[model samples]
Target: MADLSIDFCGIKSPNPFWLASAPPTDKAYNVVRAFEAGWGGVVWKTLGEDPPAVNVSSRYSAHYGKNREVIGFNNIELITDRSLEINLREITQVKKDWPDRAMIVSLMLPCEEAPWAAILPLVEATGADGIELNFGCPHGMPERGMGAAVGQVPEYVQMVTAWCKKHTRLPVIVKLTPNITDVRHPARAALAGGADAVSLINTVNSITHLDLDRMVAYPIVGEASTHGGYCGSAVKPIALNMVAEIARDPMTASLPISGIGGIGNWRDAAEFIALGAGCVQVCTAAMLHGFRIVEEMKDGLSRWMDTQGYADIAAFSRKAVRNTTDWKYLDMNYQVIAHIDQDKCIKCGKCYVACEDTSHQAIARAVDEAGTRRFEVIREECVGCNLCEITCPVDSCITMVPQESGKPYMNWTQDPRNPRAEPAPAAAVVEQAGA
Candidate 1:
């Protein structure tokens, strides 16, 4: 088996799967169970000054699929409601018991150096491995100017990261907010502040539901609810793009990335690694399933790496990053035309309706001599836009065939009789004279 261990910014773990700062890691008992269940680590919830956080009942709502299985989740839950002293004690105990398992406590407080300076030592005294600045909680804490608000501004991100670096001996991992215009701005700022690593993405704005009978938005109740941060498979693409952008940026390229957002299976983990994430963090999926899910993640990834002939985790990580590029470099002259296999057609009419209403009216409906409605492609009229090919529900019923230049494929663009762009060739005049 390939070795899955990693030393991310001096915090060593058996594997790269760490629970995010959410309900799964809220207490010591939960974390100990997670470690035993094969999770490499847990960010021991979000901690603050001792008054503790107040949470509401029904603090969450879930979106499910056809079988009512959870596909995505939403939360109005706040930070830890336990006393800071209790949290510190739990962190101390958990670290002492499982020294091999990484224990990084996530911290969020007021945006000043004095408050940060005061808290770093207290957290470090627990003998924890590292500290992660919680700059990405989008809903509850943003209104107080600490979560997404702080993350939205690159200056504030720098200021807080610098303060953490100055105050704590532990390596600092800046958790980023996805609510910004560009994720790279704050990521670069974190590196400028001397942060050792960065983790993302905290969640996207979302509306889970609307109450029709009560006429109210969900969770917040009485008053309308604004969008809470969205997490799950749906947000994976967004997170992957942002992670790639940060990883490829010249200013931030060398900085370590802890990829989060929509990571459920080993494939998701592999994608994060390919995009330059050193380790991957998951919350919603792990919580949706159990922590034992990591067992599958570990086994699947190891098997895949072995088959690919990679020696270890680092061998495959960021392998795909080298291939990612911009669109302008793509070959512009390559072209394809759509083809439909009549034998494979189910006559669902999905492609015809989609093409007619939403895209170009390239596909035409006609009555065959047998008095049945039939769909046919007018090769002369078809521009090969591929709307029909994509919308076709049947597999292989529609395909796009590459058209060679000067081929006799009769599309609207190549017709000499049609007057759109290119002028009639002088050879055509000779042909007309000869006629």
Candidate 2:
């Protein structure tokens, strides 16, 4: 078996899986149960200053699939609703109970150094391992001149991170906000401010649905509603791109990254690690299913590593970054064309309609004798771009097959693979050679 253990910014975990700060990690009771279920560590739900913060009712809304299950989630919930003293006590207890697990406290308060200075010692005295500055909460804390308020301005990000570094002996990880235009700007700020690691990305603004009768937004509790942060499996690609941006940037490339947003299972975690995240964070998956999902995540990741011959997490960490260069560095010679199997076709004509109306108009359709819709690929007119394959609903109904002989090479006219190659009507060369 390959080892899934990871040492991220001096904090070691049995695996690279850590629960993001959300409802699941709200207290010690929930975290202890999660640790037992195979979660490696947890960033406790963001704790606020004394007296704590309050949230609203029907605070969460969901976007559903055909099955009517939640695919995307929106939340107006703020920081820890519990008092500081109770949270500090629970952190102390949870750390003492699970010494092997990473207990990193998440905190959000007023953007003053004095507030940070006051809270750091209290959290440290609880025997917690480290602290993650919650500068990424997009919804609640911004009104108070915190969370993304501190995140959007690079100077504030650097200043708050530096304050945490000065006040606490624990490792400081600056959690980044994705609401900005460039992810690298705040990432560079964190590294400059002496942060040991950085985690991303807090959710983006969203409005899931609207009520027709009342003409109000979804989960309508009153006369009005505000946009909440959007998250789930749908946002993973966006998160992956942002993570790669920071990892590939020369200024902040070496700093450890904690990948957050839309991580659902082991494969998602591995992809994040490959893209240069030191560890992975989960929130929506746990919220959608339960803590038991962690068991499958850990098992699945370990099994994949064994099959790949990776001895440990470090062996494959940041492996994908090497191949993720800018667009100009990509291989221009790669080419492909679309293919459709007549025998396997259900004759839906969906591909033809989509292509003709919205795409390249490369697919032609006609009704056969059996009154079934059939689609044909136009050889000369086809651009071979594969847009039809993407829009097609049927499985294995459309495929993109590369053609090597019938066209001019768009990116590479000549290659070592086919030196002294003659142009197309390539079939003529074959016939002449046979004679």
Candidate 3:
């Protein structure tokens, strides 16, 4: 059995799975139910100073797949609409009641020292584990000088982080927005501002789809629609890249990360952890399938960990960072050619068509003695691009098989084709050129 426990920037949880600061954690009722359903922690929905944020009806719109599964979720919803006092009181009671579960309060306010300074003490008084500066929300709050409005600007990210660090005794985790051209700038800014950790990535700015009849985007309000924050499985690849960038960067390598975006299963969570997330947060998955999904997540992760010989999360945490590198550093000599399994091949010409028309002409089609259609890999022409494998409908029908080239490992920098390749011994250069 593997232990899923994690100590994220001093806030301990039984497992690495936590509910993100979204509708799922909006109130004590929702949070309590999540905890009861086996969540290890919850970031209370973004809270603001009193006269709370007003939300609109029909605030959510989802992008669905062919089977009607949510591929992505978009929202124009704002932060918590409950009063600050009520939120604080509830946070206090919930933290006291569930001392074992992590209680990190997410807060957003006008970018000012006064507002931040005032709210820090009130939230700290709730006995919460920590405070996550909600600088990542992309919709309703940004217009008010909060959320991505502040996060997109490195200066604001640093200043607000400094203010929160100055006023609060709790660990300040800066929630970063992904809207910026470069995510590292804001992450570095957070570290400079004395942030304890950073969580990302906030929802992307997107309008899922437009209603052709009404000529308006989704989540239509009357006859108008504005771009909202986009999340869910579709954004996982983007999120993973960002997390890997931060984890491998020299500037913020030591910073703790709470991974958010498109995490629905144990594999997704494991990928984030391997890329250096201290914990993983879930929102869209919970909304789509309910909190009980965490049970599957926990069980699947634990079982997989056992098979991998990992005793705890830390055992595999950030394990992939070393392997994540620039394209220039990749071994040019390493090669793998596609192999077609005749037994498993479904005789589908999708792979053949895809490779012949769009990619390298690496697959040959013919008829066998029985006049049955057959497809085989043209290994000599295969560039090891994996296009055939990806297009194949049957699993494992096309597998990439590594060849025994017996060639020395060489990166682009050392390759002879590179005009600025590093100088090598005459013999070595000749050998490489011949190879």
Clashing pairs in 3: none
**Per-residue alpha-carbon lDDT of model 2 for 1-435, expressed as tens digits?**
988888899998888899999999998889999999989999999988878898878788888988887778888888999999999999999889888898899999887889999999999999888899988888878999988898899999899999999999999989998889999999999989999999998888788998778898865667877888888987788899999999888898899999998999899999999999989999999988988998889899999999999999889888988767664223345566788988878777778888888778888887879887778888777777788888777778789887676543322223345465334443443333222
How large is the C-alpha RMSD of every model relative to the true structure?
A: 8.2, 7.1, 3.4
Better by lDDT, candidate 2 or 1: 2
What is the per-residue lDDT of model 3 for residues 1-435, given as tens digits with 9 covering 90 to 100?
999999999999999999999999989999999999999999999999889989887899999999898999999999999999999999999999999999999999998799999999999999999999988888888888889999999999999999999998999999999999999999999999999999999999999999999999999999899989999999999999999889888899999999999999999999999998999999999999999999999999999999999999999999988788877667788899999999998887999999999999989999989989999888899999998999888999899999988997777777889999985554654444332
User: TM-score rank, highest first?
Assistant: 3, 2, 1
> TM-scores of all models?
0.84, 0.90, 0.96
Clashing pairs in 2: none
290 in model 1: Cα distance from truth in Å? 1.7
Clash count (model 2, backbone only):
0
What lDDT does the true structure give each of the candidates?
0.85, 0.86, 0.93
Could you tell me which 10 consecutive residues in candidate 3 have the lowest summed lDDT?
426-435
Clashes of each: 0, 0, 0
